[model samples]
Target: MSTNNQNDVVSHAINAAQANAEDSQAQQQVEELSSMLQSSTADANVDTSSEE
Candidate 1:
């Protein structure tokens, strides 16, 4: 193949890798946030119950 085609392939590969990494990071963030929300909700419930 020509040099330009080779460069295009390389560029596409880099972009795909970056996209995958970003998606993985986003998933991790969502998981962490979900856990934090669940923990905070449980704590709030416990505190409110104790006050009654």
Candidate 2:
């Protein structure tokens, strides 16, 4: 392969790895937010029930 082609391939590989890492990080953030929401909702429910 030509030097230009090799460079392009390496660039693409690096970009793909970075994209995958970003996606994984985003997924982790979503999971953390969901867990926090669920925990808060459960707490609110308990408080409401106790007041009844």
Candidate 3:
């Protein structure tokens, strides 16, 4: 392959890898937030029940 073609391929690969890493990080954050919300909701339910 020509030098220019090789450079383009490498650049594309790097960009794809960076994007994948970003997506993974976002997914992890979402999961963490979901877990926190669920925990808080459960606690709230317990408190309400006890007050009844």
Candidate 4:
């Protein structure tokens, strides 16, 4: 294989890896936020029910 082609392939692979890492971190943050929201929602519901 030519040097230029090899370098292009490596560059593409590095970009893909970086994109995947960013996406995974974003997904984890979303999951964490969802969990926190659900917990707060449950607590709020309990408080409302108790007020009745």
Candidate number with greatest TM-score = 4
For all candidates in order, the CA lDDT equals: 0.61, 0.60, 0.60, 0.61
The 10-residue segment with the lowest total lDDT in model 3: 2-11
Q: Which tens-of-lDDT digit does each residue in 1-52 have in candidate 2?
A: 6445654665565555556656778667655655665566567657766887
List clashing residue pairs in candidate 4: none
What residue pairs are clashing in model 2? none
All candidates: CA RMSD (Å): 20.0, 19.9, 20.0, 20.0
Q: What lDDT score goes with residue 46 in model 4?
A: 75
Off by over 4 Å in 1: 1-22
RMSD of 3: 20.0
Candidate 3 is scored at a TM of 0.55
Q: lDDT tens digits, residues 1-52, model 4?
A: 5445654665565555556656778667655655665566567657866887
Model 3 segments more than 4 A misplaced: 1-22
Relative to the unseen true structure, what is the C-alpha lDDT of residue 1 in candidate 4, on a scale of 0 to 100? 58
Query: How far in Å is the alpha carbon of 31 misplaced in model 1?
Result: 0.3
Alpha carbon lDDT of residue 49, candidate 2? 63
- Could you give candidate 3's per-residue lDDT for residues 14-50 as a string of tens digits? 5555566567786676556556655665676577668
lDDT accuracy of residue 18 in candidate 3? 51
